[model samples]
Target chain A: MKSNKTNMKYDIIFFAVALIILVFLFLAYFFMTRSNGYICEIKKDNKIYGEYKMDKDHEIDIKENGKLVNAVVIKDHEVYMKEADCPDKLCEKMGKISRVGETIVCLPNKIVITIKGDKGSDSLDSMTK
Target chain B: MGVKSTKNIGITSLFLALALVLSYIETLLPVFIPIPGLKIGLPNLAIIIVLYLYDFKTASLINVMRIFIAGFMFGSAFSIVYSLSGAFLSMIIMTIMKKTKKFSIVTVSSAGGIFHNLGQIIMAAIVMENYYIFTYFPVLFVGGIITGIVIGIIARELLPRLRKIIGFEIKGSE
Candidate 1:
């Protein structure tokens, strides 16, 4: 009975610690990733496909081998996947992104759209440096 | 010895079937959260229960087989890779925690849940070759915690009943 009580105490401590750390990480990640971004970088299969300005409202149809795989739209300082042919269409449901480090990924098509600020202004790499 | 081993195998197979059914049921449910990779991780209940009831080897064997069969049945090739990494990492953490014998079932299970999401996020980062995927980590982490606790509570309730029926001696951490 005594050991059981001690174990219960340990469990509560572990739970509190885990909860605090994860909540801290969640907040830290949120603030760190939240930043005004002007440039949108699109990549396919880890290769740069195009870069677009978020200030401009336009539509881009991403093509692979003469077939449309995804459509990206930029409007009102935000970007989103307007349409995607991917089986899951998760990218289309990712909503819109206007902050640096935000991304919409289409796994089946291997496409990633990331919001980035001007070079060296708010780059995550520079933040680490 | 033969009879004991057979019983072990039989029980392990039953757990595997339960895990697979849970996986299938999860797929059939509508996606409540728009986040692409976030899941309630229902099948983890079976895995956690098995880990506590049997040894690590038995739990992992059931886990791996369930992942393969369920992945092929309901998910894509990429899902297998993602789940394999997640399950492998979670099992390692759960086994370590269980070995310590200081934490409760809920703690061990929740730890397993958090690491499972982390492992999947890591795999997604590698596959997408984009670090931005880590942004989803926070939401998934919280989701893992909630689901883990729920599964843990259920397992805690079911374990004693299961032991009563199976008549196997439970070792360490009552």
Candidate 2:
């Protein structure tokens, strides 16, 4: 019992320190990845559907055999699933996404919408425009 | 199998059912953030409880059965693969930590949660054929720790009382 108590104490210290480091890393990533420009990349069934400029306001309607299955809307540099035919509507409820590396996924429809930030050559215009 | 083993099987199946129901309820939660793959993993409570109350093999069986049943009931084929990998990895890690008897339940659970997320991320990278999926690691790690701590605390508080109530001699321990 006494040894277990000591083990608990040491374990608490270890987990506390680890949690602090994780929080630090999370905050650093959160702040560092907050670029203003992001590209909305859409994928359906693991295949690239389209890439859109966040700067442009447009709605993408994903159709299957001339039937609309999902709709993605990008306005004022934010992307969201505006509509989906899935029963749960989880993708629609994911809210707006503006950050790089953020994604909205509709599992039922197998649609994934992710935002990619400009990196390397800082080629924001070359790709989006 | 002996009578004792038969009893163990029944109890393990009960734990499996509990875990599956907990997982199902978790999906109904309206806590869908914009980030993908962030889940509170409520079923982890049942896994931890079984690990503490029973032996490693029983707990692992419950974990596997729970994942399979929950996947068939509430998840897609892709999700089944992701969850199977994550649950298996987390179970192995937690069982080892429990064997050490050097860490508290919360610490073990937190570690389990973190590894579970790591497993899912690896599977996601493989499935998507994109190494860039690793970019979600940090956020998922933080979320895993927070949720893991919560689960660990709950398990810690409940275990002693449950052991007393169940009135079964803990099958194995130091």
Candidate 3:
């Protein structure tokens, strides 16, 4: 007798989908590769937060609550509140950014540094659109 | 069989207890290895075991108990939405796997893991009123594969023995 068909043929589809997942993850990591970034100049109360090199791995210094604070970030220069003493350092753990979606927000310090495309469009559009 | 039968009730309760314990234990553990948006979901063992041992409906009910009770106990009142979303999709996967009974535990559990994560992310999207949350899918899928294989192996080993106990015991004993 001819070989009878058994089991679903769709398992092949699952394997293919898994392969796609692996490839997509690689591409995501590649797109987020480490690199030097633009130096963002921060100013507060007309006082300088100093110029910082936005490289793959670095942090910039800013004084908060009468003390110096360091805000580190990943490539693409997404600023986050790495260390601050404003009664709550919640923003410190917000972590680095490689994606183009949002900003590292430190409401206590009134600081909001967002990442954007080359054209520097609005953060909302680059993320939502 | 009488509901009072000790063997019948004992076995079901044991698995239920196992599920609950696993749920609580998972929450207590420190969670590292961020995959953007996915739960390690180590508690799936009880469900998978019950699916193979007692019955699908039974396993499903236990899953619900685990989610709801765990949610209540954690006092993470805000996270109810996320828990329900993940539970809903994961249950759907489990139901399909129980019915088909033709796939390896690894494949089925991986799908279940993926759906569970998808459900939570969908809920997060709804709460945030944004679709950008979908961007986390890739990382979540990768996490699913890893967690699923680990959990699948646990269930794979536990299920056969559990089934053997149920097979020789009174009805509903598993």
CAPRI level of candidate 3: incorrect
Interface RMSD of each: 1.8, 4.4, 8.1
lDDT ranking from best candidate downward: 1, 2, 3
lDDT of 1 by residue, A1-129 (tens): 999999999889888898898889877787767779989999999899999988899899999899998999999999999999876677888899899888888877878898988886675746544
Instruction: Quote each prediction's TM-score.
Output: 0.90, 0.82, 0.66
| Location of the lowest summed lDDT over 10 successive residues in candidate 1 chain B | B165-174
Clashing pairs in 2: none
Tens digit of per-residue lDDT, candidate 2, span B1-174: 221665656667777788988998998887655456689999999989988987777777777778778888887777888887888888899988889778888888988888898898788767765444555678778778889989999999999998886664434421
Whole-model Cα lDDT of every candidate shown, in order:
0.85, 0.79, 0.61
Candidate order by DockQ, decreasing, is: 1, 2, 3
Q: Which candidate number has the best lDDT?
A: 1
lDDT of 3: 0.61
How much does each candidate deviate from the true structure in C-alpha RMSD?
3.7, 4.5, 7.5
Number of backbone clashes in candidate 2: 0
- TM-score of predicted structure 2: 0.82
Higher-DockQ candidate of 1 and 2: 1
Once fitted onto the true fold, the runs of candidate 1 whose alpha carbons sit more than 4 angstroms away are: A127-129, B1-4, B168-174
